[model samples]
Target: MITHIFNSSIVSGPEMLVIPALKKLGEAVSIIFLTETRLPTESARPIEYAMKFGYDVYSVPVNGRWDKTAFLELRNVLDKISPRIIHAHDVKASLYLQQAKRVRPGFKGAIVSTHHGASYRKGKIRLYEEIYVRFVLPSFDKVLCVCELDRKSVIHRGVPEGKVSIHLNGTDRPRVLPEDRNASAATIRKSWKEKMPELPDTDAAVFLGAVARLSPEKRHDRMLKVVASFKKREESGHCKKTVLLCFGEGPEEQKLRQLARTLQLEDRVFFMGYSNTISDEMAGFDALLCLSDGEGIPINLLEAGWAATPVISTRVGGIPDLINSNEAGFLVEKKASDESIAEQMWNMLQNTKQLTSVGQAYQKRVMEFFSHDAWLKKLNEVYATLPGKI
Candidate 1:
């Protein structure tokens, strides 16, 4: 059996992939959560989900850094489960597992890790990646990358190429059925407008949506700037009314809201926090926006393709691999100005006829390259090759 280890306290892209994987793996796998340092709400939902699926679940304190007690607790759990394979979801989990391996030498399971993102780095974060990849990653039997860029990044960081492999992240079909998307969208738009009456009401409104944590890497401030520019265009009567509705919760939430207010986009921009049914709401949008400075194939973007909603994203990380720039969807530069994004949004609104073909192209690519079944089969094959697997 294989045991999956990941952080269960924060709701992020990696957590989204990890939860569904645990559910699908079912009885063949178990999960160990690296307990959050802060209050766990959305992140803890995965643990509840594992329980619903009747899968064994455990937790060990992990404070995002080295914790000797967490290592001991993890070792004890490994001793009890005695899994044939140990799959760590991110760097921290891998670090903890490496320490546990040293402490519990008797448990000889193959160690594996998934590099989830190509995040911006500086100071301690850069130091951590350098140390981890140079020292810790080599010890793993396999280091799975979510994209080709991440695989190269791992190798460039001093890991042996033989130990590294790419297992492109897979996306699930839209959780919301086609019949339900429209109704879900209408209901959300109505309810949100009712809650905040300052937002303009117009039958010609173009809805642009994004679901991402309000973090620096997410570039939410950049999204707000785009919204500001779009609103400027709207004022000039260049197009119909435009609004940017964001869904997700994170540390940068207040700062982003403040930026929105400063940009005088409070009326046109809305931060709806986390939504369990964001997929259902996609049908209401004209296009999904991903303005992150870097990413590892965002789940929201994939969900957009499945929902047949076109995308407008910055060309970063694995994004270009999916979007073909004006064919499948729009691809802005990594440091694209708000005016550029706003101009694209306006053009997309004006050229609604092209959306259908672009969405189809993206959906086709998703089916061909990013299917969940194929990803699971690859993972199982890797697990079977491990030393203790029967």
Candidate 2:
């Protein structure tokens, strides 16, 4: 049996992507999870879902940033399970696994690590990552990356190229039939009107939404600026009234709200905060805007496309690989001026036929490459190549 381990402190796209794939690969596989965050009063929804697929989920407390206690806890778990292969996600988990291996010399499982994104973007590497990559990464039998860009980042940080492999993120097409296009559109419009009661209920109103954390790298402020510019154009009788809906929340929430007010967009921009209903929300939007300064094959893009929504995103990281300019969706160059992003939005708003064509194409592409079955098969292939217990 193949055993997979993961750290789930921050429940985000990476957790969503890997856990589902691991479950679908087969029932014989066992999954063990470790999270430093205190366990919720109730089991996590993701953990519950994995259990239904025959996974054995476990949670134990570990110091969030400290290595000694975390490594000791991990070592105890490894000794108990004695999994045939050890798979760790992100730098922290990988470091703990490596340390555990050192203390328990008889452990025979091949170690595998996956890099989800570039740590350089967050801040200088923490002391743990600095030491781990230089000393522990080379010891892993194989390193997995979610995209080519992330793989390159890992190599640049000292991992050998021969030790790494790239695996693009994937998603399962929704089992539901295609939503009634007209009904879905009308429901979205009605919801927007309720949110912005001052706005008229007409096709003249454009709804733009983005799903991302409120962070410097995500550039939520840049999106607010685009909305503000559009609002200014409307007041000047140069464009239709537009409303911006931003989902997800973080430390930058208060700052972004302040910026919206400063730009006089308080009445036109809606901050819905963090949500688990992203897929349903995407289905209701006219367009999806992604303004991240960097990324690693965001699951949001695939989610939006799967919902048949056209996306306008910055060309960074692995996004260019997923979207074709003017084909699946529009690709705005990074550091694009607010006016440029606004103009792209304006053009798409003015041409409904073009937007519809692109949205349909985007949906087709998602069904082809991001389906759950396709990802499960790929994962099985990866597991087959790993050294297994006889």
Candidate 3:
């Protein structure tokens, strides 16, 4: 059986992508949560969900960064489980697994680590990553990358080319069907209006959405600038009033709100914070926007595509891997000026028919390539090719 190691305190794309796979795997797998730096309460949802799948879930505390206590705890769990393979996700978990091997030399399980995304850091943190990549990572039997770009990045970072493999992210199509979009959208919009009285109740109101954390990398301020530019065009009576609804909460909330106020977009920009109904609410949006300075095949864009919602996103990281070749959506430079974003929005406003056609094509691509079944098949192939015989 495979023992997966990861930090489950946050509900990010990696966690969402992993849970469905583990659920389907049943008793074939188990998971260990490394909560050295986070509260056990934060991991309650993921743990409860995994338990429902009949997978054994274990939680261990690692009190500090580079803590020896974390290593001993992991080694103890490995000894009890005696797993044939230890699959770790993210940097901290991967490092801890390596330490477990040192602490318990008798454990002969093969080590596998998934490099979900490149580290975005500076100063001491960046130096630490450079050292880890050059020395610690090459020891793993296999290093899985979420996209081709990441695989190449790993090879460049001193991991042997033979040790790295690409395992692109995937998602299950939501239970909500395309035929039921009208009713679902109507219901979602009604609920949203009740919660946000400032939102227009009419169907004509253009609803653009960005579903990501309010962080610097997400560039929500740029999204606000785009809205501010769009509002300027509206003031000239050239377009209808539009509202940009931002979902997800993070450190930049107050700053974004203040920027919106400064731009006189208090009425045009609405912050919806976090919502569990993101997939169900996709039908309510005319388009989705992702202005992040970087990305790793964002699950939001994938969900939007599967929901047949047209997306406008910056070409960065694995984003170009999804949108550049497809005729289904628009791509802009990461440093694209707000004026440029406004121009694209203006053009999209004049030709709404493209939205439906593009959205359909996007959904087709997702169904063909990024479906859960395809991802599982690919994952099985990766597992079969591992160095150690299972």
lDDT of 1 by residue, 116-137 (tens): 7654556776787777778889
Query: Whole-model Cα lDDT per candidate?
Result: 0.77, 0.74, 0.80
Instruction: Identify the candidate with maximal lDDT.
Output: 3
Q: Once model 1 is optimally superposed onto the true structure by TM-score, how far is the C-alpha of residue 130 displaced, in angstroms?
A: 2.3
Give me the runs in candidate 3 sitting further than 4 Å from their true place: 37-40, 43-45, 119-128, 175-179, 387-390
After TM-score superposition, what is the CA distance of residue 118 in candidate 1 from its true location, in Å?
A: 2.6
Q: Is candidate 1 or candidate 2 better by lDDT?
A: 1
Backbone clashes in model 2, listed as residue pairs: none
Q: Distance (Å) between predicted and true CA of 74, model 2?
A: 1.3
lDDT value for candidate 3? Answer: 0.80
Question: Native-vs-model 1 lDDT?
Answer: 0.77
lDDT of 2 at 15: 73
Order of candidate numbers by lDDT, starting with the best: 3, 1, 2
Clashes (N, CA, C under 3 Å) per candidate: 0, 0, 1
Candidate number that wins on lDDT, 2 or 3: 3
Q: For candidate 3, lDDT tens digit of each residue in 1-390?
A: 888988666677887787677655534788888874556676676677567667789987878678898899889998888888888987788888988889855777888888777635456756766666777789898888877777787799889999888777788767446677667667888899888888876485788899998988899998899888888778888557888999899899999999999999989899998887876577778889988877778888888877788898887778776775647788878766789878877787567778877888888887778777777877777777765634
